[model samples]
Target chain A: MPAGDAFTPDQLYDIERAVRYAEETSGLHFSVYVGGADSETRPFAIELLNELDDPDRTVLVYVDPAGRRLEIVIGELAKRQLSDSSAGLAALTMQTSFATGDLTGGLVTGVQQLGTHAHQPPMLHANDEAHKL
Target chain B: MIVELSGHSLLVFVGIPVLVIAVLTLLVFASSIANGPRYRPGLSWWAPPVWINGPTATKPDPANLPELPELTASTQAPGATATATGVARTLGGASASW
Candidate 1:
């Protein structure tokens, strides 16, 4: 934590890097919302997702530090890339860090995990020339 | 032999070491000092919201946007369109608490 923002500039850089890596790995838009929810978080997060450019291809991570709640919302198309079980595992990783008062660490690791899970490697031998080997 | 020092000599010898110790202490705690408060569970948080990797392009406000009734109230209507986009959608997600 810093004077102005919740994180230091270095921490912000780390978080942004994690977000960028996640997006690059998964080919899905990733967004993180950190704050208090006006009311229930899930619906509010869905509303936030709908506000995105492509709601169907996005993953939104909502963290309520004050309320100590974390919600991960995967868009329809994004869900195909990122499974609910994977999201749950990421959430577990974040929860452990967050419970220890490590917000920045939690976010970075969780988002990174999500992105890794969503990654799809190219088919190894889908080419006609591969049979020649 | 016993040695006696003047007040100025004591200031030079004793005060300088004290000053050095103070500076060293400050340097050691500099990072923690720079980073003000830390988030501890069960304690109230005071920072504002931070959105990372958010939308590069903004859209019209919700007031101006059309809504699909199903998404508006999932429990209210069971037979309405299954998604906000008027198509059936399967969403994957997780939730947790600190």
Candidate 2:
């Protein structure tokens, strides 16, 4: 690993894979930011979320590793799929791992948990006559 | 009087200690090296920020992005949810600290 890099290539791959899995499972955009915030973490995280191409449907995970802070910001539309309580649960998972300095493990686990919480089971035989609403 | 180190003495004293020290060092640092750098609270951050799964493949210029307004008392009112991009947004999120 390089002297100043936040993650090794393997660690980066692990986190990216988790993000991909989350996005695939939830059908929502997932972004992760790891660094300090310019201001209060929440508003700064919100600004970061808004910077996404489709902010209304994205979920942003912002981590201030140095400050030991974490924020999970769900988009207006994405919140429907991922509730605030679910986000809190994911944050708690990350908080525990980060406490032990397992950033990659924390992120991967937390993102995977978020995806599971937001998962919407597929409707079987939606067009069948008996299943019509 | 001249004293010399035979192959047997070198192997017993220098070679074995060096091998054992090397093995111990590897055992101690193997996990951290494999996991890469870690962040300890209260330490100055070392690396620049990393954003994974960026919204776009290409990086957009920050200047073109809209600025978030100063958080005013009124703007934070229960029903005053909106974003800098003119999109009415209600943010749902959770915060945590170690």
Q: What lDDT does candidate 2 reach at residue A105?
A: 91
Can you write out model 2's per-residue Cα lDDT over A1-133, one digit (the tens) per residue? 2349898898899999999999899898899999889999988998888778888788999999878899999988898999999999999999999888788899999999998898899888998999897
* C-alpha lDDT (0 to 100) for residue B5 of candidate 2: 93
The per-residue C-alpha lDDT of model 1 at residue A104 equals 89
lDDT of 1 at B48: 85
TM-score of 1: 0.80
Q: Would you estimate the TM-scores of all the predictions?
A: 0.80, 0.82
Please provide, for model 2 over B1-98, each residue's C-alpha lDDT reduced to its tens digit, 9 standing for 90 to 100: 99899999999999999999999999999987777677665667768899997767454665697775667665565633567644456778899999
Write model 1 residue lDDT over A53-118, tens digit each, in one string. 887899999999888999999988898889999999999999999999988899999999999999
Docking class of 1: medium
User: Where does the lowest 10-residue lDDT sum fall in candidate 2 chain A?
Assistant: A1-10
Write down the C-alpha DockQ for each prediction: 0.54, 0.56
